[model samples]
Target: MRRPDAQAREILALAVPALGALVVEPLFLLTDTAIVGALGTDSLAGLGLASAVLSTLVGLFVVLAYGTTASVARRLGAGDRAGAIGVGLDGTWLALVAGLVVAAVGAASAPTVATVFGAAPGATDEAAVYLGISFLGIPAMLVVLAATGVLRGLQDTRTPLVVATVGFTCNALLSYLLTHGPGPLPGLGIAGSAWGTVVAQLLMATWLVALVVRGAQRYAVPLRPHARGIRLAAVAGVPLLLRTVTLRVALLVTTWVAAGTGGESLAAHQVVFTVWTFGAFALDALAIAAQALTGRNLGAGDAAGARRTTRRMVRWGIGGGVVFGVLLAAGSPWLPALFSDDGTVRAAVTAGLLVVGLTAPLAGYVFVLDGVLIGAGDGRYLAVAGLWALLGYLPLVAVVPLAGLTGTTGLVALWVAFAGGFMAARALTLGLRERSGRWLVLGSD
Candidate 1:
């Protein structure tokens, strides 16, 4: 085999650590699910609904990460380190405010949010409890997101990888201890899991904030939030927020459909969806790399480098997806056992896993292209493209229930519409945009 090219080496340098960070990000949820799953089917299903709502809320603000990454990387590439840090600081401040507002609202309306998914009464109550406590962690979560973007843009994915690894470890230890009974520390059921995760998130956020602050001070960048800077950051994030909202809505709808199918099916779908999300984030490691590298290249006016990087990363993305798909397919028989004890739930999860495995490659393609556009600061196009993709997804999902399917068969149909139809729609839209070559604009905008 030939030696790796310079661009390939560069990509790996960023992507490898980024992979660790991204993969660990989802492990937080996966761990919580595994722990809370022991509480029984209703609890598992409830956590599913709460997780869906919480993720959607956090995901809508993903611009805190993606937007900051692009802006910081561009400025850094243009040799304005101080300016880059300033943008990241602005994002962090915005995250704090947004998180506070969302937490207050989400906590107050926990039952309303939980019931919207239509899970069983027991599951709904459990979901509400989890949601109420979990909302308190949103600020830390968003802070971590914005701060991680800063590090990634600064070409320091290793810091995030290390911090996330430690955080996940803390979450796992705490989740196990709190979720289960031990001496005086009695178990709090799903609430215990929520508290554990929140504490771990707070720790991670503290570490990240300190790091960003130190970086800002080193660059002589002001730590205080500037009105104009914060406003500009928010303005820049709106389109990305729209893009993220459409994506989140699609997921929320999927959870709603799963909820309507019955508790067993909902529980199974929850496990499978968590695994699918884990795989998605695994693939998104490459996307994160693309965001950093592409923005940097364009900021340096090296459009050719950006093009070459994109081409190379696309191949890597597909290859990574193939590996993950194979793993998902191969593990389907045994994977569900780890999450639930119900035979029906296990069977449903196995079927869902197969569907997710089949669609993994398509997801890889869609995600990388998405990162490329976002890195180019082409959020406007992305927002429109996301809408088109969501429209395609809604009709296909609608057809699932309209067909009058139920039980395992219904779950399979829903997964097909989601894994197959939704991902395919995303691929089509992103591919068109990539082929047009319009996102390769130079300089920090």
Candidate 2:
């Protein structure tokens, strides 16, 4: 048989599972919204508030995964297989420690945070209950995040995708059964949703650990503790961590501002944002692919190859964006009904979908460029660019209300500003850096 072409195979290896995992994330959240919306508007609102808070918090630790993946990819490119394993193990420890801290803080401050989000009086209690339960599973969640990052770094997106699919499937089944109280199952309401996620996290974490243990024989280095390595890893990772946290706080604040508008406004914002995220995640797989290919090429001292690969991926990302955007626009009316039956919510979501459709293709460039930067081991630039984006949020917030665009219109405008501005800055920075060819000179080790 004729050998398959390298680029074609590489694209498939990265894109397929990455897209599946991304799609699955929205499916899980959509499922939650559907189940909770059936309970009542209050239940739906509470779940939305809870999710906004949780997602922000989780986004903070998500840096660990991102940083870990970049570092491991560099090591792999450098042919330091032992170093890659060490980085992965150290990242696992870091994620666990960080998760514990988050759990403690989340448990103690769930009520206060929920209140700050302006959750309705009745919704606050439900939000608090759900947040508290979800916090307990933070450690497991972090482990899975770290493991998935490591796998991606090793150019193995398929395994993480499989694990995530299993976890999400289980979560949906348990959540539906418990929340609706089918047969002998007692209805636990909103809390049942949180329980489903927690249980799934535990299962996914366990499976990841087992897989890592079994696969260790393939690594050049043994997966063991490295107490002395913490300082170096911490130093390399701290800036990225802070950057992630800052960006996450910005998002949390944006949600808080939306809440100040009204419940329907917040709900509408959440639905549109969720749909936007689907496109973001789908394109991000390409970004991940770019990161891997670029990092590997850089490590091999192939600057031309890296540049070519990045350009190709950017085209692919944009194409995916256009396709998904058209699909989202076509289904604008039907999409909101997937979340809520409320006519107001449906109308708001449908109105916003047009802007979402137009902006998504533009937004795809940002995702692809982000992957290129990360793969280049350009974390500092990522951090700085994010800070720049955060600064833009304030102006968008002030302008939204002044113009009398309260609901989805304001939200879509804000996202467009975010995606457009960040991509411009990132492109300039990366373009300059790539032209200088300094990235090629940097040692992966």
Q: Which candidate number has the best TM-score?
A: 1
Superposed model 1: Cα runs more than 4 Å off: 33-49, 111-129, 174-192, 258-272, 326-355, 406-413
lDDT tens string, model 2, 1-445? 9885788689779878888877776677778888888888788888888887777666666766676777777777778766776777787777777789889998898888889867578888888888888899999989888878778788888988899899989999988887888898679999888888899999998998777656565664566667655556566677677667656666666666666556776788788777777677778889878777777677666778787887778788778889988998899979889989888878777866777787677667777877777777777766776676667556755665667666656666554554455445545655666566665544464
Model 2 stretches with alpha carbons more than 4 Å out:
1-4, 35-43, 177-182, 185-187, 217-222, 249-271, 325-352, 402-416, 419-423
Cα lDDT over the full model 2: 0.75
Counted clashes in each candidate structure: 0, 0
The global C-alpha lDDT for each of the candidates, from Candidate 1 onward, is 0.89, 0.75
Q: What lDDT score is found at residue 31 in candidate 2?
A: 81
lDDT of 1 by residue, 271-343 (tens): 8887888888778888999999989999888988888889888888888888888999999999999999999
Q: What is the C-alpha RMSD of each candidate to the true structure, in Å?
A: 3.3, 3.7
* lDDT score of residue 243 within candidate 2: 66
| TM of each candidate vs. truth | 0.87, 0.85
lDDT at residue 58 of model 2 (Cα atoms) = 66
